[model samples]
Target: MFMNSPVPSSIGGIKSLARQIKHATGASHAAALDSAAQTARFQNYAHAQRMLAVHVAATPLADARSDLYPLFLTFYWKDKESGERGRETLTIQLSAAWTSLITAQQLAHNRSLYDLQPMASDHLEGKHYCSGQMEAREHACAAARVFQFMDATRLRPSASYSRVYPSGNSRNCIPHSDHPSVWFDPATRRYLFVDEPYKRAIGEREEQERERWAISHLQVIAKATWRGMYNPLQQSGSQIYFISHAFSGVPVKPLVAAVDGIPLCTADHWAGESATATPRFNSPLAGQPIPKAKPVPRARMQHDDPARPPLTFHREAGLLLNKLISLCRRRAGIKTHLESVRDVLREFLMRTSAEEDVSDAEVLAIYEISNTSVKPILRPDWPQRSALEEDMRKLRGLLLQEFAFKAYGGALARHLGAAERSLGVWH
Candidate 1:
């Protein structure tokens, strides 16, 4: 559903109205444009009537704020005469068929928001002399009523608002049109973002700043209404279900099957090693037993590290692990065991570094032995490690052999020769 503000014929007209209202009232140019936009969009009587018909047809008998509610639509247009300013607000209720599909609670919730007091032109006309407090009180009261409808209907809260229009050279409508809104879930008392236009206004670099402000404001409101309620679901273990697309490459597998009015465990239920047990499948038509397919020999592996690595590496690895874990968590899919390979390498390095008494020759011999054992573990299809090793060897030969330990040298020749001999690479 859409919530639109009034549209101005030109940005200049909005600024002019702002200038006219600035001294007599404390209104800014931005505020004027926003007010003008809202009036144009939602105050038009004809648009409101049309929207009411649409809403009734779309969400008849449904709760006002239910998803079944048609877009909370609004529009902006100029008055035919005077050209002073105008706005329109329209809410299209849901049809009976749609309402029938949703549950009773959803219908109740939809009615609350959908049954708002119609947007009257008298409200806009009063703006000429009404104080900011008076106007704000009216807006808040209307919004509160909408919220009450949402609470009574028990609909999940969500809010959204559109961007400012009448572009360029116009006053910055960003501050005026931007609204911070939320749907209050009284059960948890959490105020989640229902409409946050400011987030869409700022560019990508300023997202964190905008999010911080939004989160902080929501927290304050949540704390006031219900102590420590702002992020309970996020902080707690709440499983949010989302529809998966085929392009996402997530595997879908059935976890349970219904047979002869009994629930049968699928292959996903058993441990990866317990794939041998074949449950008997009963067919209703034939009344004969059908053997279940054997579960594949799926290996489950985990990484065991004695010490956590540095924070930088840990953060990078944690991000990668999260992605990998998500892939592996899908039902019936094969989970690759890469964590074991990382753990083995980490342990080997730790052991080698700890044993300082070993001579350089002994260390080289150990490296050769471990390399033989570890090479097979590296993927044969990829040359990741071999390419890295070759690059390092080439760079090392160029810098240390050709440049640092060259036969021709000045006063440091003796020291260079000694260092090269110690490294056991000088001819």
Candidate 2:
């Protein structure tokens, strides 16, 4: 069946049409995309892309002023190192209402943004998006859902004794022959659970014999409606989602079932210095009921010294410094002045690893290598002159008095003043 000549105006519309194509023909995502393009009389998906362009006048989905119903997944675990208990929730906006079940489910299964790629790190889950906040009751409810899921599923037990290998040192390294306890099986279109060691510790006897363990009582509960996305244009105009995860004491849940004779516990308590007590987990199995969620603790701000500005302030300052550095490099007479500014900002930006230390020459080299033209010193309403000026003023008001900023702020301030006089961004 052919769709009208032009493709759907919105990403959501295209996705909906693709789902229909997928269901009717049982086509893969890429094949469905090709089928969609064919509907518009294009040769293939790639051909359609070549003929199409984003409607620039139309506001991108991210900037749309509409109420978006976001899907959220919260994880609860105990901090292995600090023994601190905390909870984190990550969200992705799917539609305007929860009733858009099909659209949400499709996206949940297909989009890279929806996959909670759990990683071993001191910080929050490496793939976790920016931090988010929800109500205490909601947090508990999400937590309980995860706990109940774990309670119902029986994980394969860790071997009582096994030969320790030299290569199995990394906390994240799964044995070559072993599969993760919870995994999405594409062929079956279901999340399957098997009886296996969900997490374990080993005493390696190579250079030194020591015990290494993964996060204890770590339970992951991912709930989604549906999933798929434009893979090629992920960074272009795709919706920007805030991703994040949290680790805290497992929330309380009633015992659902037991493995062997031992009962499973999902009480809110920190995992002590023993590995035997940590409860194993499995993914939400296919055809299982979603347990109703209860209450959990609300999110809290990490304590930080008031004297130090946050990462955003560091970035805002870097933006102004970047403009100054760019201006210096553009003018042959002032090219010599570029090094001092670069050195100062590079040190400051790199201090927190917030930005890079690319020199002006390097930037130009990169542009050349990438086959993209270096932007002009100024473009008409390009950076939004008014916004820059306002940002500068606000930054000055906030950072000028800070002790840390005082070290290099004066030099940057002078350079910015000169740039304003010459390029006319800051009035």
Candidate 3:
């Protein structure tokens, strides 16, 4: 049920699909998984359609022609490395959210991107953003909640008007008209970080470099997505694609994946929630601490960031290794050796972070511990000693010199040989 598959739009139809999947006893072993996947599938369609109806006010063409792409929603995440939910696995689900592109095209346009700031430059002077047919909540063509929630790690906080600071005027705002942020223009099919306004902020050379970085980033996210990601919470096929990063240190990844039935906002806030929902703290009339207001009750969405770890396979392996370790200790008998084995297991797992590796001494110590524990059970014959020597040789294989600088060859390695042999798939 992916990659351009037809999906039901109505809630009733979506629920029915899930019910059918669950009832399909023919798939007994994975009935629950099938049901959840179907449910996610249907929700994905609705969000994709939402994207199509919206217009992201990308840079207008130099020839005065409108330039916009039918945005394809994809999941993206950042590693803690980039201070975004960036530097992590990016995902793009194959299903294009809508069951029918024609139907999506008919929906009322609801939002715009990158053009939500106070003013536009002479390069984009006549460009405009649409709030569509909804007029009630549309102010300044952008809302503080939308900006903040659209990207959790991107925008600087409280730069926008606050509900707490309602008395303050818009003069406190520093407009992007001075240094405009950039985004990918779907219509032009070009990274749109190189407009006149941006050139004024970073010189032409820096702007060009930023554009290259953005392209390389797009490729990187796409590669990571294709490598695939598993949302432990959702248990479905997903890929998070890091979309656009601002020169202003605002990182944005726009994708449509619902977490716990609530659509995730790439920003700090979810869609439809207002910046007023949880406004910044108001300053006291003088220097005194401001009185706190009772928080407004709102539905909290469970976010399934595709970039979150430990990933499915590695985590599965970790669980299996833990089982193996437990079994080894139970059989090894000697308590002290079991303790050393446990340390061996723990430190090797640290290699998963790619920051550490196993030491030769530790490996040999573990080998000795295993040897000590196993000797008592041997028949005290040539065969027993031969097996012991062979096992020692195998342990040496687990401790390569190259492992000294990198993460350890884990318990998951097939060459873990005798130590892990008996535990095969037990966990």
| Candidate 2 or 1, higher TM-score | 1
Give the per-residue lDDT digits (tens) of candidate 3, residues 1-427: 4334344333344445555555654444244343433334321344433332232233222211122111122112223333332111111122111111112221122233233211111000102322221221232223222222222222112212221111233342222223222332222222312111222344557545544443322211111222111121123323233322222111222222221222332221122212221222121122333222122222232222322123233334333334333334444422233344445544544453454354555434432333333323322255644544444333333332112112333331223433433322222
**lDDT of residue 218 for candidate 1:** 16
lDDT of 2: 0.32
Residue 318 of model 1 has an lDDT of: 34
Estimate, for each residue in 321-343, the C-alpha lDDT of model 2 and write its tens digit: 45534543454323333345445
Question: Which parts of model 1 have CA positions greater than 4 angstroms off?
Answer: 1-46, 53-191, 194-201, 208-427
Q: Which segments of model 2 are wrong by more than 4 Å?
A: 1-309, 320-342, 353-374, 378-405, 424-427
**lDDT (Cα) of model 3:** 0.28
Off by over 4 Å in 3: 1-427
Per-candidate Cα RMSD to the true structure, in Å, reads 27.7, 25.8, 23.5
**Tens-digit per-residue lDDT, 203-238, candidate 1:** 555544533332211111111111111111222311
Candidate numbers sorted by lDDT from highest down = 2, 3, 1
Model 3 Cα shift for residue 104 (angstroms): 35
